[model samples]
Target: MTTATTASDDVRLSAREAAERHLRALVGRDDAVLREDQWAAIEALAVDRRRALVVQRTGWGKSAVYFVATKLLREGGAGPTVIVSPLLALMRNQIAAAERAGIRAVTINSTNIDQWQPIHDQIHAGEVDVLLVSPERLNNPGFRDEVLPRLAATCGLLVVDEAHCISDWGHDFRPDYRRLRTLLAELPTGIPVLATTATANQRVTDDVAEQLGVHADGTSDAAVLVQRGTLDRESLRLGVVQLKTPEQRLAWLADHLAEQPGSGIVYCLTVAATQEVAGYLRDRGLEVAAYSGQTEADERHALEQALVEGRVKALVATSALGMGFDATLGFVINLGAPSSPVAYYQQVGRAGRGTDDATVVLLPQAEDRDIWAYFASLGFPREEQVRETLAALAESDRPLSTATLETRVELGRNRLESMLKVLDVDGAVQRVQGGWVSTGRPWTYDAERYARVAEAREREQQAMLGYLRTTECRMRYLREQLDDVGPDGRAADCGRCDNCGGVTLSSAVSDASVAEAGQRLSRPGVVLEPRRMWPTALGNLGLDLKGKIAAGAGPGRTVARLTDLGHGQALRQLFREDTPDGPVPPGLAQAVMDVMKDWSSQWSSRPDAIVVVESATRPTLVNDLAEGLSRVMQVPVVGTWAIRDPSVPPRAGASNSAQRVAAVRRRGGLDADVPPGATVLLVDDQVATGWTLTVAAVAIREAGAGAVLPLALATQG
Candidate 1:
């Protein structure tokens, strides 16, 4: 609540006027004026040289505050502004906006690694006024060791975009963002800093503001300005559609997507669902494209442009398209519910940015909780795994790369890397040139804190479910979830939601459309690409495997991915621990046969024999699959590989590739003799890491099989 002491009244007013002029230039409108709070924020940063956090709605001109402050500060002889952004899409949009305002802006991100050196040169040469870098770049060994120190010392203003990610309590917490505390500690005392986010609740807001208030000497100033506005989006009309099945949901979209006012986004919970929904919509003669983290960078850019320019009807996407993607999208439809209401609010905020009224609808399906549970399994690892990682790092004479560390720990590559980032931020480890090194600093496990976070996440999930069935005002519920307190200390109801008697979406869908959707979804198969190379550093695990693997298995086929919209439901039910072991059901049997009928045509040679990978959990299902395929394809059942040991507990899962491979090699071997150079069919009930199939195929090939055409009932996409 303290004002900047250095700026007098007249000087602050003059700076405020200059900021408005900059805003007018940026928006290309002479009449454009800064909102009261925006001016207050810019005044604090530009004139007062103090830290501030702006928690405003998505379209409330938070970017304008920073851009204007950057311009005014640079004019007063401050150095270039360093903005730590989260997404490439956001960086692109900011660069474009900076150009429109005649401010020189450049970016350093994964997509433009070749341009980073020149960008750094421009910043050093005083030619660039603004620099945008991803938070992940803050931990890069070269950047952290070489460029970041200079940037921190010389940057005029530090802007943290999407700052909610810096808080572990936030819905979309990122480990790399924890590095911000280190960066903050390096900044000079009087250098201005601005952190902006549209999605932070009270807890996230307080967390970020506390970090912002820290000084170079490790003391908190308590003078950081926190300006939080209402979280309501006036142009969004919210509603929900409760559907019984995935087929009916797709039918609803197929029936109603084109009817939306303008081009928009259709969101799904999983990548496989994105592809499935986009493909089905396109087959229904709608113009759309599937977008996710798995999409190529070039294609993502093209698809984004298509949506912005109204070239495509919509982009069926996952959370990949969530933060800071700017478009005048007229509608946003969710194929499934997100696990957290805060995250849901952020995604839906992408729409109605430039429109009078945007359609926002949630189509909640029956399988959403299952998807939530699957994602929950990927949260923070157990304490033993973290201890093991630290122990390995402490024992190594030299820094071990993530791949090398993976060979020592039982964690997967992604999860292990994430845990290391958090530890680095906590002073338990440090990232050096080659890899990570133990800092020898004492650190607590913080089991109670982790438990509290888990409890919070559970509450958020249950609240999201309640959202689907709530009778109160939908918009008010969302705002309250974000802790948005208005001037009256309460979130008021918007008269536009379905529960509030606004424009209600039709619940009726054509019988023909539903039938078509069901038929299309029932047709299930996913092409499984074969692993061409073995995981690195297998020698550490007493295996000689490395380098490009010899071709033991060709491309394979699975009935469906567990994330798919069609037979995925059935597969999920069948794989549940409570589900009893039995033969393959009639519907799934037909699906497997159908997959075989289509997949066999793509093979170079038909299989002469079938080999089953024994499943300890579902032996009957795997045996029945092998026998049925043997009868149908006229291929003999030649062998069985007991990869799943009964004595070894499955409590600790094998998500890591090297771990799975080592376990399979220990217990798996072909038992039946094979004809030399004869084609073989490998059957399994499910393919998770795919190591069982790969290892089994290698052993079968060593047994003199010509080619392995592996088939599975489902895949864990």
Candidate 2:
């Protein structure tokens, strides 16, 4: 057997032919052949051993190029390929495809802990051909410092899937993906590397291409970027509906989900939307399931399988199921428009892959930017916050867990973790065995760069808005947004979209279905699960509260989550920062009545008395709540939980459990005596951590109340 080592395309005709044969077997078809560009990538990676980035459209055979290349290289006695994929769904689909081609593939991810050792043993024995890992896996101290270095040096081909995430200026900015730079530097020279993504604007393409360069002391080696595919999915018919309200959107799905060709996806902008829309669909007799990052791993797998097998009408999901779910979906409808055109293009790409004539609809909403703003508000915190974090970690001799850091800083837990990851990439901090440790590296804070990224995001928002209102072809608009040019410099209208076809999509859903949807969403109340266990490491904050909260801190009811579909919008308006801290108006009081009435059956017993928590900012609201309950439930307003320090207001409901517990403990007390064995209803404007209600219940229990039920206007986490 003879092998050609040069990457010259003309020198590897035999190998490329064999690669096409393997591709046919992989796709399970008798007449499958590689497109010209697919063979080009394989030629570069397998024969030339040159670094490359392939910016092809979804379903453009990018994976086929890598798989065929891996097979050919391994046949020539090369080492295994290492692919860093972003999502578990993508990994599962890729593994199945690898098996069809008789390639031994295995994965290392957070979900499959039990199989990691066995998989590692197989790799050590040289029995595996390809390995898939998530970007977060690169941050695992054990794997990064130990296993990754070995894999980098020996792997025949390195693949970065969804490489758009590697760019900070991109819409989907994942801080962990930046960790790829370390692995890029670790790979030996001439070890072929492939970076592939479906959604990258010209700026992102240039940035990722530059980053993928095999730099040696601030220089680069030759690299090829194959970006030939036009971003048009010819099988799609795109349309947008500007709905007046969330209920109308849900009504549209309820009325027409079954009208979609087959099992598909109904994407929601938030978990709240997913839950609300999925529940409404189920009520209307659609076999729909909700999937989100918050869903348990086992349940998420079950939902994905259900959708794949066509057992459900649709999966109501967030971006959790977005990256690479391989079902050949027949349709995809968004509850609201995604903030970025590039992100929207990537998501809609999930449909129309293996089928003809798939429907893609965007229900652009008035509240879309409101939801986007909610996320942006939590983006990269101020420079002072970063400095405080570094100072906290640097001053400590031992590694500090995130819980410990929360005591020293006011940042939310999620935001704090995000900052840590970004700082880790910047070399100022590192995740170690116990937690995080400062590396003492002098890091310069680039405020200008962050501002530029933020401005880029705003531009993306505007572009997405343009997509909704554009009179041109929807496919052409998205393709141009991604900077994808065809064999001609610009692509033409496909004559398939609603605009090009001159057809107005029907928003004329049945009136009866719309009424039912409105009823479902308007009916309020989300069960407020009580805090069972106390937050860990409260002792670090000088509060020794630990273990489970007391029994009196039982399950309760809230009118709505501040992010819910029903009264949430109204309550949010009332809770707006500029809203006057006044008494609850009669209308909102009635809304509370509706929630309590619906929740009447869930409570074991009615309250014997009402207790209000003293709110320094909303005293009138608290007083009104107590008084209104006294008139409605015929229970006396017994007392208020007094604040020890009136100047220290309660933290937002989104605060970490540790800080909320500490704050509550610091200012906690029951001012009035309670009747022994009396049931109490604790009233407040909202519950975020549930600690406020839990601590109040404890004080009431100490005063001899037998039962406590927390009732609040809103709840959040």
Candidate 3:
């Protein structure tokens, strides 16, 4: 994290200047256009010979730095510069840029494999200048056996782009990057190696260098370039919105689009959710496109073209669309909280590239709260997990199924898979024929040293995660991590995050009040009595009803009458008639009525039916009421229902009579035939943050349901 130290006194022109003058003359350049800082970094790279890790933030022009180093060594009569990039599109872009700069560059990828032989011949003949290859392409035996040997014979400059992939701590870790160290070992010493990434922090930089075998004492003289004092476009305003329902979220997005009609991307957590959101947007009269891993290449290309041509104003996507696809997007909206800070930054960076002003909006859900909590609980996977994952992968001779690993390791399937992917990127294992296999080498300085380093790296990752979950200035955190503290010793307030804007709920109130309110409304015995008075006992008490009321079922069904105020003529009438054993006490009815009224006003903006139960009420009152309402209203419930306390755990021969009836009601029961193109209604007992309903709605749409509506007894605002 240390900044580059400067010389105390400048020497006018020394022996080094004379040698540089000669070298520049041979390279056909009169002067090095690189800034002093860049030149110092380049000189360090040239002197150090080992791999150089450069952690430069956005707009620092990392590509230019590496290009200059490549030219210096290649033009100085060294070997052809070999650059391993991550994406084929990026390879093409870099090669095109190089060619435009009048530098000879060639790329070997899927499309132009036919030209690979000629490129190989040129490199071996020492006629090629810079050779760009995808990591996947580098793993090809044809290139490894033939072209690599020639390149090794005349080793010059080796450059790795998206170098963070070499570290387990990186967001976009790739397995191909792990084999890079072994590949480099095949070449001779004295060949200067450079690794460049825009997002790597100190931990990532150190791990990447170690993985590449660039550090001898596990210490690297890596330089971190912080793009401090730059304004992130005045046009771009970051905002966060808290929503309680899927319908509200959709309506909000529609309003947002109406206000700003431009190209944008909506990032979702899952492919299925992306598709659902895209459909919902389209239905709402917006030109929308969707992309995910499951999407066909041609379809994705067409979507991309549509967005670029202004034919589609919005795109819903998973993270399948990666770092290098440069689009002139107007906004980037995250539908749920990102799992990591690096992911959040990368996705948000997609917007505001060309627009005068753009926006990055985060719509967090309750499910995402679990995601953060899970991350907090595990923090980062411990060193033991890493070692176990590696040892298991090494033991497997073939590409091991993630499910198998999960069973054996006793780790959650998703977590285990993520860790395995990280290990694969660090070069400890490879996805073999059918399972993971050992790469026959450890990532760092044996087991003990690696364990220590792994523990330290985990702590850093946990700290970063905590920072991301904070409601503070994100830009300030970035600056602090890069060691560029402000003059006032305090980062500038962003005035955007949930914390700064005072949008977050107080811990005490959010934890106790919302849950208690939701519980009162959704409780099994809760009943709503009709009210016909304004400013009555319930109204005077300032109660709001927020949960569902269960009514009895039979030929003459009991009603759960909703009221603005629970204490009124309706409650008095019900007590006087229904409770005949004694003269119904006014005080008790008024108190219960007050709670009901408060719950209703707090939940539903409008009043409706009062929940009146017959003499009999079942254990699953909520489910029964939901089923009865769906039948009565003839609306299909789009998701599954849970009976909180089943009489008995479902046995092999037990009949699902309740389930059958519910399914019948869901498909439009005997009461009414299924309406043509009727929208589906998803019913739930209670909602904390509406994430379950959102997911259920998406599933309904995917199942060919015409429209989806969520019906719940209670919800958290």
Candidate 4:
């Protein structure tokens, strides 16, 4: 025992000296020093070989601690460190930092599949010091079964970056992150593990710490030593601007973006808003571009660089820019409020990192609540759906692809994919190249647990509402929401925010700006691309549908998208279930007529007649629209297609294109007696899959119609 203690003390002294050297190199300064807590974490990992959790705020040098410890461990003849990073952007940043310290780091992710072999070779040669991978890669069947076991046996250190994602209690819970437990259980004895995050609250911190499991002393109660610090940003001056309408918000943003701090981000709640805002800003002569999930990866990288170099004034973005993004951004302007205070804080943290003073402003709008509810609806699957999926996979003789299973399931493709990921983590199923197969493991549907999470989400949203209504210091309210009441002796008010500092931000917008913004928002019409081909996979379900649709719905137009910030609100209310179906509203009728007149050139000829696609839920709305168009054009209302079987359950709202087409076929075909080679206009209340219009147009074309023109008030999901 005495000999072991002496040896450990010697290792500790050497580790500290090595840590300081690496820290200096890492920071690119000879006199640089590590924080007391940073050094403590390094000691725990490099000397004691203990598990640790560091929950410090951003810009707190969490990555430095890991890199320094890794250098020490590798020098002591330990294998390379393995880090599970949450984002590609984060990995990019980490790799550059590691190289600065003269530590060799390599990453394996989807983007560099071809280079993975060379990276693996380097690790086998002991030429690599660190290996970073995203959580999703851990579930790769080949890697999990073969390569991961070898890494587990020889890896010197295991690091989980943005580790809060591991816990469902976390603001962002990724199913793939939860799979880390399997990796944890398989690690060789005496290997130190580290988990780091800047945004986890007390609940998330404790949860992640427990998962890290007992320290090097063989202590079992808490496996990791968790070190937390205050979530205060002294440089951030937080404020809020209340806008009565979307136009007002856009106007304010246009009027003030140039006057705000340096290059920054303008966050929108949706992709549509980003496009709209970015367009308006560009029209205002501000250099800006839309950045969202739809932006190409290469362009996104360029945009990130642009912001870093202050080449672009701002990049209007969505939550896609919420995490993983690293910038010394000078300001952050939120066009809409996030659903939770934690999410808000996480986003704002991206700014004020490099400067002494940066602006963080929130422009809250009532529409934000509707957007929140739309996202909230996509929560966990029901027990029936889970059991159905499991039973389908278990009963199959061979692996069934997602496309094949779609025929037997009711959920949409995206939702099904998300559920499969969760189930894959739970060991209920396995995803192979051909498709997925059941693991034959028994699984329980945790209804109560999911319900608790739902309730928690509701509570968080309410807290956000509370934040918007609070009169105290804006920064303090946010900190308290994260349960970050700082040190016991810390000041209650941050004194940097609008409230505590007694500074008032104006909501004034110049008349010229308001008119410009109003015209931009009210500008109508969205190109509706016709369905060129039937959605693939219909034949897999035994339907004779594949390849280019020989007969297709042509290019069309929608007055607006349901997600549009302009006139979509009125269109949505008109289609709501509570709003009884009736004749077209006079204003909507006028708008439709105006749009048609503007699109007259697109049509080959005027309509000889108007044909309405039947709607069980809104029969009156469709019929009224058809009749109104006919009356305005002085054409006859030819006929309406009726659903063949009232007993058949509702199918108009089917999720996928293929299924939606099948449902329309089952409902009934078009019922029209048409003269050969006569032009007819087809009208529907809304276009979703566009399958309805395609099917109707096919029937009409087969009946010898010269052209079928499709029109609708809105395009929806």
- Top candidate on lDDT is 1
Q: Using lDDT as the measure, what is the rank order of every candidate, best first?
A: 1, 2, 4, 3
Which lDDT value does model 1 have at 364? 90
Candidate 1 lDDT by residue in tens digits, 34-129: 988889899889888888999999999988989999999999999999999999899989999999998999989888899998888888899999
The collision pairs in model 2 are 7-47, 7-48
- List the lowest-lDDT window of 10 residues for candidate 3: 549-558
Worst 10 residues of 1 by lDDT: 644-653
**What are the TM-scores, per candidate, against the unseen true structure?**
0.98, 0.95, 0.55, 0.94
Model 4 per-residue lDDT tens digits across residues 393-492: 9999999877767766766787787788889878899887678999999888899988998899899999999888888888888887777884673337
- Tell me the tens digit of each residue's lDDT in model 2 across 1-717: 012245444558788789989998899898898888888788888887877888887888888989999999999888899999999889999999999999999999998889988988888899999999999999999989988888987888999999989998777878789889878876777788899988888899888888888454555554555555667888888998777876777778877778888889999888988988888888878899999999998899889999999899899999999886788799999988898999999889989988987999999877688788878788788899899899999999999999888877778888998889989978899999999999999988899988988898888899999998898898888888888867676768879888898435788777897788778867877787777887778787887677877665677887778777667778888888899988897767887899888887777878899888888878898888889889998999888888887555667323567777777767767877688988898888887777888888888998899988888888864
Instruction: Estimate, for each residue in 1-717, the C-alpha lDDT of model 3 and write its tens digit.
Output: 122323222331232353355335333567845555555556644433445666665444456655555655665677777888886546655675666445678888766768988887887787777888877755554665566677765867778888878765676666557657656565565666777766665567667766655333333334422222332333445666667644445455655664553788888766645765676667667788788877875677677767766788878888776565555777778877676566666677767666666666777654554434434444335667667667776676566666445434535454665556546546666554455667878575256654654565455456555654666665555445533346675556665444555223221223333443333222221232221121111211233311221211111101222210112223323333244333223443234334434443434222122121111122253445444554554544333523233442222111121222222223321112223344544444333323334333333444444444444333222
The lowest-lDDT stretch of 10 consecutive residues in candidate 4 is: 1-10
C-alpha-based local distance difference test score of model 1: 0.89
Alpha carbon lDDT at 609, candidate 2: 90
lDDT of each: 0.89, 0.84, 0.52, 0.83
For model 4, the stretches where C-alpha displacement exceeds 4 angstroms are 1-10, 214-221, 486-491, 539-542, 604-608, 649-653, 675-680
Question: Candidate 1 regions off by >4 Å?
Answer: 1-3, 486-489, 643-645, 650-653
TM-score attained by model 2? 0.95
